[model samples]
Target: MSSKREEELLECPICWDSFNIVENVPYILWCGHTLCKTCILSLRWAEVKLPTLPVQLPLFVSCPWCQLLSFRLVWKGNLRFPRKNFFLLWLVESANGNRVRYCPSSSCDHNFVLPSNRSTVSRNGSSSSSEYLHETPRSSPRDRQRTNHSLLGGWRILTLLMNLTAKFPVVIIFMLIVLYVIPASAAILVLYLLITFLFALPSILVLYFSYPILDWLVREIIA
Candidate 1:
């Protein structure tokens, strides 16, 4: 059997859960093999493999079991959705390290880790450099209402501007070209229609889906 397969079959030395996939259990990966997190934790960092943590580390950590450098591990967490109990595959490092990366999928259970460069660049090259960003999550009713209004206002203004900018120019160009190249004009009109349809169809579908959900939320909040 492959070493990875063998590692998967063997029970975690700590939690005694099967490697790789456990029923809502956390496992650490060492040399492409998985072991229980608890087992990995309890072992004196010598018997278990440790993956490279995402953030900067003072030194590199090695797996105790396989004597190889580790990179990824999975573990369960409290945050959950409809059916699946999610797990995090995080990098392991010393006491002072960076947080693990959250999953990128709209609905994801696994939080994976990524690598970091030795030296990072900043505009000022100052240690005091900071980044400020705002992200909205599942929000309150009032917040949602305000955001919806803002988005709608922006969309309306943008559409109006787009129509004004495009309609006259398109019409004049079409008319001008049509005076000479009848077949070319026909082809251009058809292409324009297809392009508009391609873009507008997806938007219509989005509105169709979003409207019902937004309606329900609004009603529930209002009630």
Candidate 2:
């Protein structure tokens, strides 16, 4: 894991504060973005999109940065989500040595270790020995290969469009100029429909699939 610089550690994406590792413990989303727990809690009402199992209360979290949607896991009622970035947590501890305190309410200050698995309830409503993130570095190469292929396909299509734009820049420029040359209302409507089909539709599908996509990912890791 790459060591995060101190300046990067201080900036919380949500609240924009110098978030600490203890109470404001960082939680990772399937998209691999980390946010302060407090900020995540405040997003309890975030809209959940795609749920494969159709559980009674399927949770979802939308990445504020990338706008990518992911399955928001709830071990109990909180957004347990992905494993806490333990590597990052330890880095913060090592850098802030002696100054790090796990609990804010306790008078006796000490760093806090992650909770035991027995203490946390599994999604299947049974006791589990494995913590949500315990020993999770076991992704299979085949699954990864398939995902990479899909991404590569998307990239190739995008590159083709970019090449076309570059080769026929005048044609594209003329089309844009033609659109604006039309009546204002007609131009706006044309532009809106074009953007919706070209950008919005694909983005929505990607976000919708993100939940199941990552679930398969976690299973591959666990396996």
Candidate 3:
């Protein structure tokens, strides 16, 4: 059985829920505190927004314990996801008696499972207390080899493309010159430029309009 302090350490400060490997994974904040992933997602919506500032600006969330503000970059009106605290996750799993073992080989990315009935033996032949190992079935060596080959082939193709681009920069310049020289390609280029400008115009306008308001807000916040 885990101690009271250990149980408290495994619980999220915000939700008061115990951390688990599945839904309640522990995510560490910039302020050196950990919270559940669900609570972090909730914080995104709870962040205070400056009505006068542009909505595209990064959002800030105050830590529940320290009140220290942490800025999260916005992507499509959503805050950037925080990193998971794997160490805390391991501790939680160990406390729950679910011991996860990884493959000893550096080449093998997948985990191999040990039988729950067997005791895990150490290098010195000492037996440790057996725990339930929950892991997916390991891939065969042939499958691993094929996967590695496929990844290597993909990297080779990418390197070939990069080498071609580096060796034949003149070809790219010639293609660009031809595009402008030809009326059809020139019209296509113009249309592409127009589309890009149309897409970027709204953001530009928002920034232009919100500059003054943002300046005032910064001064007020700093003061």
Pick the lDDT winner. 3
TM-scores of all models? Answer: 0.20, 0.35, 0.36
Which runs of model 1 end up more than 4 angstroms from their true locations?
1-10, 14-30, 43-60, 71-223
Clashing pairs in 2: none
In model 3, which range of ten residues has the least summed lDDT?
98-107
The 10 consecutive residues of candidate 2 with the worst lDDT sum are 101-110
Predictions in order: lDDT? 0.45, 0.59, 0.66
lDDT (10s digit) by residue, model 1, range 1-223: 2324323434455455653333424443423334554544444322332585444322223555545544332237431211111122211221012112222345332332333433446687744434433332343556545544654455456446544643565678888777768977788899999999999999999988998999999999999
Give one digit per residue, the lDDT tens place, for model 3 in 1-223: 2245566877998779999998898876656567887787777423444777534324566668776555555478543655676667766765555222223354343444555667788999999877676545455667645644654455456446644644475677788688766878779899999999998999899989898999999999999
Please list the residue runs of candidate 2 whose C-alpha ends up more than 4 Å from where it truly belongs after superposition.
Answer: 1-5, 44-57, 98-223
The order of the candidates by lDDT, greatest first, is 3, 2, 1
